[model samples]
Target: MILKTKKPVVLLFALLLSLVLVGCNKTAYINSNNISEPSELKEALTQQNTVIIDARSAEEYAKGHLKGSINLTAGELTINEPVKAMLAPQEQINKVLSSKGISNDSNIFIYDNSGGVYSSRVWWTLKLYGHENVKVINNGVNAILDNDFELSLDIPSIKETNYEAKEVNSSYIATIDDVKKAIDDEDTTIIDVRSRAEFDEGAIPTAILYPHTKNLYSDGAFKSTRDTYLNYNDLGLKKDQSIILYCKSSFRATQTALLLEEAGYTNVKIYDGAWLEWSTKDMPKADKKPSTPATSQDAS
Candidate 1:
């Protein structure tokens, strides 16, 4: 009985299987592509190769956050005092990344307690520094809780890591001058993604309102699309329109832009400068009050 041992083949197969398993355990880099779901996130974090960032206030984070999440409040990035101190310069960001044991290649997911406010800001900031593996938690805290993931109160020990900033990508952001040019260009439609009050008070000279919030349900998530096309049609927005969106800051505008893109809009841009920059700049704004109707006696 000559039984040739297939031991070498079996060993090669075992090695390949091990390599596949190891690759699967590595952190998944997210971008516009590979946007992970809550379940996927749970699995990814379990592998211990990801950095979950809570883009909410430290207090809010303390109340509840995804397990093993690090805090870098979005408010801090926007010049708020305490949080800002934690993120004043690139050195601060590097320090935070190091403390969290995050490296330049870490898969980062940023979420906020509020809807999309701070999370989107963090998304924009990470992109500003040319970090491509970062993503915003689509529904923020709601997504995590709804997904039945556990939370923790333990603070993670900081581990220093090196982070390098690259030149900002001009395409991901719209400057005041870019907005001015877009307004003057007839082909572009500036959409005010703020509330009705914000629009009524005074908005970009000829911007139209297309509020970001909608009442719809998708597994407890806010419906990204309006219930009816008539809502957007009433605002003179056509399917082919090139739209620019702005809010108090770029936060809401980016959310609206994302929703618009998801809703089948072809050309969309976010004016991050938004009202914060618009109101301060020497630019035309719609007057807050409507002109009074002429008296009957005064009418010719």
Candidate 2:
């Protein structure tokens, strides 16, 4: 009877060992196409292929950040030569990302404190550089900090790796001439993703006001995919037509582009220089009420 009991116990231990091995092999990652929540980020931290990006200034990141996260600010991906905050060189971006220990297969999670402004810029930069395994943390830094998860002051030791830049996808971006051409095209739709107050002051001729915040909820999280689709659908937008987005600058445009693209809108493009360049060039501009009060025209 003792011998029989020993045989069963040994078999049970072997079975449990196999189960543990299988669990260890399992990978945990958030869906790249979806906006990631704090709970999902918590699970992603347990996975080996994940990398959290603190999309804030170095000084801000030094104060506190999600554990195991690396700092990558929007300023790093932009240059101020010909225009302020335009995209940096692809090779430079590749080198910076490689030095940060980001591999091609790494699942990047980006977050920032200023709403989704900074985080969305990084997200667009990565996507433009051909990184598809990326997601902006929903509701930005507030969502993460509110969860009461531990913040780390320690900077992680990164193991640098080679990261090659892929072929450029220019279709994702639009130029002033592109906007001019779209102005004449009936099949194209120009969207101004700024506040109604700003739109009332002055806007691109024929551009419709569809503020980027319309894509989010009161809590600051992105709405459901179905709801996002319906929201844009109410604007009479068909996925087949060319959709152009712009704001005072291009950050908000990038945010709206991401939301619409995820909602299945194809042929989407962003006028990178946006109203700043448009207004500077003496292009056709209009206001809802021409006699409205003057407001700040700074491009921030």
Candidate 3:
């Protein structure tokens, strides 16, 4: 008869082994080469086949843009109340993709001037449309200049290709109806990832402000665990809750989505159309309550 062992050593060893196995299984698959340095992008540009999209305003693009890049302004999409309408229709998106010689197989790199607000939006949009080989160039134009990449003032001629547009994943996007339904359901949490002014002045009837920046220029290229904890904790968000994030036009929301996912929030979705799409129609907006507004500064 053996004496009673302390802490059940054998049992504890078995439990530790099980935890190790579980940790190995919980892998996060973030898109690669998506937020690379300008040097990496420059090398990719010189490759035989690569599509670079300049997601800056036309004015900024006209001033100066990367060589061999196509223009797709993120701000113009929001000028119209309903931003969805501004987004090229499926046929138009397909047409442009074809005109730019971009196919399902082409490796695409997208970037913008204001941090990654536009570039991330384009990245999420491409993913929504089932284009998996898409990446966002972090730090936007400044990163290119810092890396000493060449810029061109003249627009290059685009060669058209036959690109087919497949159905987009609705789960990744939320419509006005979906937001309303989530409010009515009471089981879901709707997060407004916009500035406090945007949220307090008037916002989706029941959404709480969870503002987040695109995290390219100041806060590095990707969201880390600490960033998630700070943002989520400040907003009083629960890790287990089913969260939906949205911003003026889904740019910042996409960044928040990535952060939430990194924070172990299993069910997270981005309302790509966001407030730009929600506020356009006669959708309900929360009454403005006088309160201290949160700043849109980069999370340190």
Task: Name the candidate that leads on lDDT.
Answer: 2
Instruction: Estimate, for each residue in 84-148, the C-alpha lDDT of model 3 and write its tens digit.
Output: 42344467667667876788788888887655677777776676677877777756676777777
TM-score of each: 0.71, 0.81, 0.73
For candidate 1, the 10 contiguous residues with the lowest summed lDDT are: 291-300
Q: Once superposed on the true structure, which residue ranges of model 2 sit more than 4 Å away at CA?
A: 1-34, 287-300
RMSD of each: 18.3, 16.0, 10.1
Q: In terms of TM-score, how similar is model 2 to the real structure?
A: 0.81
lDDT of 1 by residue, 156-246 (tens): 7777767665665656566678788876888888877677777788888767665555312332233434322334555556767877878
Looking at model 2, which ten-residue stretch has the lowest summed lDDT? 291-300
The segments of candidate 1 whose C-alpha lies over 4 angstroms from its true place after superposition are 1-35, 79-100, 215-220, 224-241, 261-267, 288-300
What is the per-residue lDDT of model 2 for residues 160-257, given as tens digits with 9 covering 90 to 100? 98988776578889999999988889999899988889888788877888777766655566655556666777777887779999998788888888
